[model samples]
Target: MKTAASSVISDNDNTPAQSIPRSPRLLETLLANLDGVVYRCRDDAQWTVEFVSEGCLQLTGYLPEELLLNQRISFLELIHPDDRQMVRAHVDDCVRLRRRFDVEYRIVHVEGAIRWVWGRGVGIYNADGEVEALEGFMQDVTERKEAAQALQEAERRYRSIFENAIEGVFQTTPDGTYIAVNPALARIYGYRSPEDLIVSLRDIRHQLYVEPERRSEFMRLMEEHGSVSNFESRVYRRDGDIIWISENARAVYGDAGTLVFYEGTVEAITERKLYEAEMRHQATHDALTGLPNRNMLHDHLQRAIQSARQKGGLTAVAFVDLDQFKYINDSLGHQVGDELLKTVAQRLMSCVRDSDMVARQGGDEFVLVLQNQTEGDVGIAEVMQRILAAVSRPWQAGDREFHITSSIGVSRYPTDGKDVETLLKNADSAMYKAKEQGRNNFQFFAPWMDTQVSNRLEMLISLRRALDQQEFKLFYQPKLSLKDGRIIGAEALIRWESPEQGMVAPDRFIPFAEEAGLIVPIGEWVLRTACRQNKAWQDAGLPPIPVAVNLSPRQMNQALPEFVANVLADSGLSASWLELEITENVVMKDAEKTVATLNTLKRLGLQISVDDFGTGYSSLSYLRRFPVDALKIDKSFVRDIARDADSAAIVKAVISLAHILNLRVIAEGVEDEEQHAFLRENGCDEVQGYYFGKPMTVDDFTDRLRKEAVQAAP
Candidate 1:
């Protein structure tokens, strides 16, 4: 009953077979419970199996009887065909060296599926050191091998993207040192390679960014927000050129939640930043003159006002207007006008300090903002005088030399105005006053000027309403024949009877009408009303007399003759009974055109008289060429005739000149009997003043005319 298995165990135990109480079943149970195959094979070419454990069925899909002792198939045949020679060589070398052999290879199952397996073996040797058999353990390890190969593939893909990305990728230490940089990051920073960037750029804060504080700001944002998107900065390249860049980055923390480094992607934005700057410049600067425009001027003025308030200094805003620019543009051409404006712009810029700003307020107007002036008006005045001299210096325009002048008006901050709009508006008002002061000068804004401006604006608004509401009336002042002391004619004067303010003087609103272009309509109303009233008097069986109506400069257009004729026709009055009076300046503004228009009116049988005769620049030659029948002495000369010898001489000379030209001369504003006697003694053709009669209503004049007619009839 003692079989071979028992004998083998008993021989190995020596004296311990009874003492150890060894069981033959203990060896079988240990081998049967293993998850892998345990085998002993002869060290032959076939690796013929001598014993195979029960795990052989699950590991190789073969029963132990089928593999053991080459009963069905040898263990060597169970290995994949491709791995047989390598396995044999490896095991044979280990056996010859008397060392353990460990290997991993492929094996084929009985079902024809390939699986990965690991084998570890040691040689079972005899006392004589002769190779007997190989004993090894083999296991299935296919899942672990496949998992490791997949991880290798993923790593390869990540490395490819990192190397070839367009945007720069980097990992930087928390202290602003580069830990890792891709090839793209190196090229973006103007380096030869990633290794070159790492070696050369040690301090990102000092060596990379143009402004070193940008790096600190970056670190601050990272600490506060844990990430940053679109972090823009100006940085320098290896070639010492500056460029703009934007970064998207986050703090890379270690497993312990402490920040280790920052990982980021950077994009170059130099071109975009440059384009934005250019666009901003274009928006704030003038296209033709290259000066700051109105928009920029407002912004700069606001800042200047604020600075002056804070620093305790004065700021001046000068409004400049080219005096003769309109005439030049109308006569020469807009091309020459544009060239002149450019020249003036340059001259203005040269007149101010670098700290000041000159801006174009559009259309022959420029504004200068002088900042931080300790010398106050004296410094502002000096700069204005320099501007005046520079602008007056003659410059060429299309090969023609011309001399032009500018009128400047200045307003100081915290005095004339405290805000931008108030300052500019006050300056404009002062500019008009400069023009009124005969142009080619500068005026500082006064508090009274602001009151005048406010009053003028209110008057203009009221004037517009007055015309629509028929708040106007005509008063007639009789003109006497000095030779006979008889009422020969009457002058129709306009009066405004306002509901809000009673009896506004003509001096208060007439100038406004002229400037605001409302005079033409008001002048036409006077002409038509005078004509109709004169005709009504004639119809009332009174003596027929001519009524004089004053014409404004704006009303002296070429169509005036037709307009007068239409009025004459509409009122059913003869043109001979209506006289048109124009100021001396109006007639002399454009001599040739004025002569033509006067001739046309004279042909319609209306008499023309030059009013305010001594106040304008009219030469003898132009006066002779004018087709006027009478000249009215200006009130300025008549008022001072007795006191001022110059006034007396001017009046007398005008009388003699008018007579020489065969034109009637009339003296107005003959207030006293002495002035009347002087005018009559000087051979003046007519006289009209307060001494004769003040301006009266139409009914009052008509009654006087009736009384004169009755006296003549008797």
Candidate 2:
């Protein structure tokens, strides 16, 4: 049954071209009934239609019965105007070559829309082999042609991306030979052309390598991880100068999981590497001195410790501090101070070994790493003492000869500390001990230094919490008239009564507070509290005098005008009743800025007094520029006024200088009648000391005032 059915289908397929029993009329009827137009016409100006099918009416929206055998229109007239030349060329060319005639063109419908029709067949040949008639099939193949065109456009887009992508896309063989590369890849690898690179860079591990191991490393990472990120290395350029490159790559695998080649993008990273190095250096070193700053010091110390441990050698960690650097910094200008620091750094460098490290711990502090000290602590100590001597040598900054001294603290490996932080800290503590023993000296690590560290730590903790807990109090010392011996005003001093330790004195804690940055807030509290207390006194009918308050250098030099204004507002006191007592150190350190700041304060009606006048570097020329109302001759000059001739001379000169500047001179620390006699003889204006009565509480002060009032009436 299957064989009989298949034979019937085969006969049915060939039945269309088989001989027909129909006559010519039946053939004409067959042509009119066909689903497409079948035509033959002369190729001329009017190639009129010879036959038309019923389908022609449906195709061109025209009645085919009206236009048969050139009754109304020619087939050439239906051809689109724009495609006429192309169709004519194909037909004429085929005739000229005696080739088969096949062509496609657009034809306009009666309604004026264009449709594409494809024709195929061959040119009829004459007896002499000259073309006579053309026979072909016309079909609507517009859908198939559009689909082929879309495929071509899509291929062109992908080809464009593959050619011009910025990333160097490449493919290579398993043995690392280049197979193909884009134009971008060739430029990235510093080659003239992709073809040239492929030919010249046969062995990527050899000819293209700046570092031979780069290829090996690349292969190793690819094998292990199947991909690599930021795979960076140097490769030789065509001119042999090395350039940096980083690859983000993956391994392409073939069937059976065998590695085929590496495929990735190459990016030139030479400028990026150089920029990174520059940024790293900037982060780790001081810009002014070009020295390794505190950021780099810890790592260097750690590395030094590691090296010392390997050789079983001692690591000598020395903390270097320039003694009296502040004195010089305040005495000379900052320019000279900076030059001195540079000189000191040079001296420190000269005294140490080439392998050793020196780092600036900020300010005048330096940390030295002396690695591989063979003779133990003694050898390190000797080197440190030599460093002290070397740094202490007199050096000139411009025309002025200056002398400097350094304190060295030594901490050794496996003894004082086993790590960076501990070693650095111990060295710092030991350096302070050297400073205490008098600077320009060296000291080794001792157990007693821990006591100092613990005290400092405890003090810092107490200072932070002291304000919150209200453990800080102000003590008011009266400044009496040297002529009448009467209390005119008082100076407010801070005393800390800690729950842990009782009464931390100003002398003991003020320096620590300044160092630890607690003074800024603490100083503010003192100023406000002093002002408030003076206001209370005035409200309670006690005579109001300018309440003098000690100002630390940190507080005086930084934003003093703003702080003073804020304090006065908070305390409900006028500036005329408040005085800011600034030490000469504050005045001398940047005289121009100090003068400007003081003038601002003075404009607000606050009085300025120079405290400890003779102890600091002050110039008589610049002294006149300060907005000072009074000068407090330092206690040093007053202590030996009756005996020491130099002390007497300085005191007399200060008193005379103060009077000449119209600033009243106040002598501090007048402990006896003899000291008073001497100061009175020198024409001093104010005296404040134990002889006048020590710092007293408010109630005691009021009682003293009442008694003095009664005594005066009598």
Candidate 3:
């Protein structure tokens, strides 16, 4: 029953038993009530136990007598195999040095389960200091040790996730300096390692984000709401490539409730942003021409109207329709038609200022919105003129030269309807009016145009019906030799003899025919009829004078030469007995192609002349290049030759120029003796006018040819 303190005092042999402060029985009671074992053992290899307290049963699962004196088991054998050597070495070194020792190790219990223990002991030395015993107190510490191990395992898992996660993770101080960053974050920033990113990017506000204010915004959001989700921004990578990123972050606070740092996850979003932008563009723009489509046009027009209303300025909307586009589409195939539309889109874009917008309303229709026009209709009219000219310019479709024109109708803001739909509708009505007046022109929207649209549509229908009903005729105008005053040739002109409308002039219906694409068939009729009449005259033994047929601008195509040859053959008229008359503008358009066509016609043994010679803006160089046998002076110049000095000079100059080019000159519209004398004195080779004879019927022309043949009898 002796306590270790009392036993040590009694065994000291130096007044210990008498001087002890407490009784051995009392100390032994305290030791028995302790939560651990109090033990004494000899400093031997087995650590032989000399005495052990009753608590030994609880600490090591052994009774005091079982471990005392090594009766059943030595205390050293109780130590776990893994910790035995470390325990022995530490205890022996502390005992040899006469110092206290503290150690922790695992030990085996009576039931075979492992338990962690902490032991504290010191050497009990002999008076001579040569021998000693070891005394120690041992306690089970399994619960605390296991708790520490569990905490360590949780920390390991957290670090693993931080290192290997796909999204970037970071901890940054309030001043924008990185406190800690995972490897994933380093890779996201284009850095070799987290250390590299931390060292290289000192200022996240300026160095990392493309806009420095983004960092400020992020901080503001965190300050206001304590966290941010889907905070999007543009940031710079280490290599300086800009990319989009979205951050989800929280402001981390310390125990004192003060902001410590920001912790966040970042995701790259550049690809998603680009995809959205592409989708937006596709929705607003035309697929074929890359111009704004109707959806965007409405949006633009609405904006323009709003702006014009606010500024008290004018906004003009032009609705454009391509003249005779359907005929071109039907005849040339949709591929060529699509190409022509694309070219026209480009031309239309070039005619306007950058402040204006051009949009494809669909098919052959386009809408232009002109904004902030202080000059009102004057400026709009100028732009419309430019558009008309640009659209009418010659373009190629396949191997053929084509001249297409546009009819434009303009509607003004406040004056025209104020809404988008009304403005567009009014402009459309005006465009139909342009077609009625003659295609290839522009008109301003008037209130009356709404009512006239139906009338125009009816006229178009009637014109189409006329062709099918064979209500067209060819009238011949005699071309007299100015040198001899006799009929040498005739010009074939078309006249529509409608039962409903009576006789219609060429000017009234020819433009509509050209616009509706009926010109090709109508022109063929004229050519065939003229050729047959000339052949009949020759067959009747009348003089075999050449008959000239006028060519429409639309008729001047790669197929024209073959078509004319076919007509000549079908009519049984020799090619030599036929002549083709092309206007100056038609020949000047696509000049290279025109020259090739003229040379082809000449090779077919026919005559070609430049009709209406001085009207078009033709280059003299192109004039020299045109392969024609004659130049017919336009009526405008010939009509005023006797009175207007400018007209007279132009007439004389044209004759001289024609002579110099080895081409004959013919003056038409000569209604007076003075005009005839003026042309004849200028060495004109031929003349055609009312003064000689107006355009007459085929029978009348035939009789006139007969009289000429009789007058020339030898």
Per-residue lDDT of candidate 3, residues 523-589 (tens digit): 8888988998888989999978889999999999889999988988888999988989998769866
Model 1 global lDDT (CA atoms, 0 to 1): 0.88
Prediction RMSDs, each to the true structure? 29.3, 21.0, 28.2
Decoy 3 TM-score against native? 0.55
Candidate 2 positional error at 71, Å: 7.6
| Residue 573 shift from truth in candidate 2, angstroms | 30
Residue lDDT tens for model 2, 21-65: 435555668777765666665545565555556667766666775
- Candidate 2 has what TM-score? 0.57
RMSD of 3: 28.2
> How many clashes in each candidate?
0, 0, 0
Candidate 1 residue lDDT tens string, 1-714: 556766677878776555543356767888899888899999888899998899888888889999878888888898899999999889999999999999999999989998889999999999999989999999889888888778988888988899989999999898877888899888888999999998999999999999999999998999999999999999988999888999999998899989888998999999768744643454466545768877789889999999888987899999999988989999997557867988999999898889999999877999999998889899888898999999999878667788999999999999989999999988998888788889999999987765566778898999999999999999999999998888999999999999989998898799899889999999988998999999999898888889999999899889999999999999999989988999866876788999999999999998999998755546567889889999999875787676656568667878987998999998898888878878888999999999989999888887888888888785
Give per-residue lDDT, candidate 3, residue 368. Answer: 95
Per-prediction TM-score to the true structure, in the order listed: 0.52, 0.57, 0.55
**Model 1 lDDT-worst window of ten:** 275-284
> How would you order the candidates by TM-score, starting with the best?
2, 3, 1
